[model samples]
Target: MLPSKTSVTDRSWRAGTAPGALPLLGHVPALWRRPLEFLASLPAHGDLVEVRLGPARAYLAAHPELVRHVLLNPRLFDKGGVFDKARQLLGNSLSVSRGEEHRFQRRLIQPAFHPTRIAAYTTAVAADTRTVTDAWRAGETRDIGDAMHSLLMRVAARTLFSTGLDEATVEEARQCLRTVSHGIYKRTVAPLGIMEKLPTPANRAYDHANARLRQIVADMIAVRRRSDEDHGDLLSTLLRAEHPETGQKLDDGQLLDQVVTFLVAGSETTASTLAFVFHLMGRLPEVEKRVHAEVDAALGGRTPVHEDLPALPYIRNVITETLRLYPPSWMAMRVAAEDVELGGRKVPAGTMILYSPYALHHNPDLFPDPEIFDADRWAGERAAQVPRGALLPFGAGSHKCIGDVLALTETALIVATVAARWRLRPEPGSALRPEPKATLEPGPLPMVLERR
Candidate 1:
């Protein structure tokens, strides 16, 4: 049996099942190799399509309504066993915590991402961005994706622990995060496979990456703990942050998890989106021109600050549209705690559910010519018409990404800063594709840097 719904349960068999599944692996190959096409194909199968991960049956909530349902009803579709791989690295951080625990942690960490904090963090954002892109030479090729990742890593380090975020720490964090991002998705799809236990090269690297990532966070916490002087950064906020009712502060382990949560959650999605923004601008010169004009008008030869964000509407729209086209956090998982009905069909208890912002954003009915990179779709009037859960670049509802504002602020500032300096032209003879790693990353984006 393929575990393709036909062999699992009658409810799964009755639902439209995604085809081309293997006996044991089921949809893992499809998901691993051609994730975008695989996800996009599910809507055609049915609004709620059944697929498999290893031997376990799962449902793909292809419609935004079902996705909204899953996202909103946290208790019903919580981050339980469905996200074991992610949980391994995330470690019950706010990103993965459920119930009252999640709420309590969110209360502690929310202040660090407050609008005021976001504005304060822009200095680090602008500086770190320039540091990464400054070394670019005219007519030279560079992996913008790698650069953005490194940039975001540095930005996070500076913002998280301004006191001791040296080059070594930033470099280690960047490398370890990339390793985890590269390996996490693979582990998720092959949950039941014995490859996880074997001492294979991939397994070794994955294990090493996980340990290194935890250590990276631990080192950051140690550095921050040693510095009694207030650094006025995210680490300081988190250190002092107390619960509203109980007035409780996070313990050492809790604080460590929170730090890892920010680094893991904030870095890749924002970085990849920024990288894609540059790549898209490369492909769409007209869009690039408007961004340039906007950046020029707002930040004439000066670095973009927090206040400059309001003046850079087109830049923001470009980022938003890029997000719509390639939301890095494309697929999100939820496991049904109890039996539930979804899309007028029965979804059995403990059934793992998946939703993709990539699929929904590409739904033509929602946004016509969904594949095209049209920033105007999110422009003033048109932006209003988008459904509430339709644009889930950072997800929606209670478990929505808390760093959404911070990430958006970083994107807008980086867009303004980079657009002001150079035009990144796509490399010749390169086959561009989104690799579904930690996020839907445009892997190895070799772009030609042209000085403005």
Candidate 2:
């Protein structure tokens, strides 16, 4: 029988096991020290494992169905505390809003992320990807992570912002974003508002970087606002977009926040996906060969147009498999607005629930041999074997990633383009590990690029 509320002490959670607690500190250090292993070790206790982070009580829901229920029923469980922190960066953007407000923002931003709009950027994506791939020397070794970061930021500048920004400006923006996002994640785990208020090196660096990023967005918006013509970029679209109901538009502050949101979201997640896909392709020869074969057959020696994506089944599978293993947003947090029952446990109002895509994606039952990195697992015939809501790289329900289709299209095109020109060989002695901060960063992916 499940333990009752009365039976379990308020100080400690009863549903799942803990690694025992430190006198007053709880599991903060342990969680920070080994987040991945700590989570991966949770199934021994129960599907809904409990962990203490300082004074706050957070539960990790490892069951795919429970995760689905919580995410799908956003009305019951809203994006809370951590999401509030996200608002510190994203402001009143679509990611931080809830209920009617969320619906409205989503509706307003929906058009920019539509498949048709994203497809229009394929030529730009291909052109930019080719530019990067062509620059890679055949025998020289390069850091794949850095290469993708540069390439992806360029793609984001052109496609998302429509800024036509140069490499130096994009690099500056990327550095600022890296600092701000890293600070945000650090603050999230260990609350640091007071430190931020005081002018320490870490705090000052974060503040300065954040300010610069905001200013860049402001300048971009100002230039667009001054322009007499529409450029069909996201910044222009957002600047001119009218809310259907009130016909009111986003103000300067809100506009800047949305721009930051797009830059942070569109750039980092896609770059991480590409990194993981490339890393996996280097590790798995059969997978890369199959992907190359599929891409070649689909394109038939012709360059891939936006329309060819629908027929590229294997490319989609490769992306899906990579996402399964290395989800960019490894974990997500939400707080219950009211009392709710999830996975037969009565969760109280305001209870913090953590849903980890990393954990769910690695569940052995949901994914047989989950760590194997097999693309065929996501193929049409086999994908149905996995339960609905099991694969949550883009999240689920209303709050699912708005850029899911765009991410797929960009990744497929870039991966295929690179494969068409170069083959990446992982360095024999190099060690690559998922260093997740904001987005998963597998830093210094030293690999040799051989021209195909």
Candidate 3:
């Protein structure tokens, strides 16, 4: 039973545990089937709603204030939950590292995202966008999800390696990523992890894909080591980077971890966001016309590079709203390092904590008519009114995503480039569903490409 609505506002209100728990599975069924809806429904119960994950009970921070406490205080609630599960794939990369070690990991990787380096990477982004557009026909319908993933994988490979490996290997790596991503979420929810070990098709695919990707990367690393020339790409930066405090370069294992992290993360997240952006543009014709108009005035069919970002504020805001509505990195989880208090509630040590940017962004109290897509809100005084910590597509505090600038730049450029030549019209026959995997992917989005 839930507490009264008035009691929920009271300072002493304890969060209600979510109803409909099966004996062994708990809330896993709800999460497995309808995670986005499940996350969005919690705020009505309380700011700190308790829910079960398999056998373990986790607290979902339903309010932005509670979320800020968890994200800002990294020491008190360090990275865990899904990130800890990520360690099986990415070793000690910044994704899962904590405390001093996490700080050191950031030091090693931060240099690649410097202003000049990012500008150079934008050249690759522009070139890759053309590669995708050049192949599209005027009236062809596209599987936008797969197309965006393919385009982003190419962009990620070029920016990360600058064509160090053969095209075949890059394509193979991209396919492997799809398999690995499919298996990670199932592993995260299953308690005790015995089911994952069984010879299931999904399990086999994940294991094989993981091994093949590692081998491909190891081979690339060895080949790059044999050469002395600097490629000026992300791989070269990491290969040459020395720790600020220790003056030590990362070992091969550490490099592999970081490379895999960037390859998967760099491509997966932005691709999903762009896919959503195009789908939205298709659904909202008025929005599509404005974006196309902006692109023409800004670029005149020329490819959009990183420096052109300022000229395209509307495209950026479209991406921003897309992120708000369908944040790919939907669920951010942490474990309480010790006993702590959040939102006037006592939280015990070792509690697994969860926060959803998707939920907070959709809160009607925070943003009125939250379901509607509005880019103009981010343009004028309305944008200024957005509460701090309310928009967390890239997260916050010390552990915020390092490639945020690059992600935004790439998304805006792709949208601009696509709009310059064509307008995406969502295929009306298909009913799109949000498949909650490693990212919140728009499953099977077939869009007809209408040449503007």
Best by lDDT: 3
TM-score of 1: 0.90
Query: Which ranges of candidate 2 are over 4 A from the true structure?
Result: 1-15, 18-26, 300-302
Say which candidate scores most in TM-score. 3
- Tens-place lDDT digits, model 3, residues 37-83: 88888877787888887788888988776677678779988886566
| Cα-lDDT of candidate 3 | 0.83
lDDT string for model 2 (1-452, tens) is 33343323232323674677576677777777877767666755677887788787778877766677678779888898777766765677877888898888887878777777777755678778888777778899988887888898888788756645767888898899878878877776555556667778988998899999888778887777777677766666777777878887888888888878777777778888898888888888998898778777887665666777777888888889889888888888888899886655788999989888888888887888888888889777788788776789899878999888888888888887777777899999887788767776787789998877
Candidate 3 segments exceeding 4 Å error: 1-26, 53-56
Pairs of colliding residues, candidate 2: none
In model 3, the worst 10-residue window by lDDT is 1-10
How does candidate 2 score on lDDT?
0.79
- Candidate 3: residue 106 lDDT (0-100): 91
Q: Enumerate residue pairs that collide in model 3.
A: none
Better-scoring candidate (TM-score), 2 or 3: 3
User: How many clashing residue pairs appear in each of the predictions shown?
Assistant: 0, 0, 0
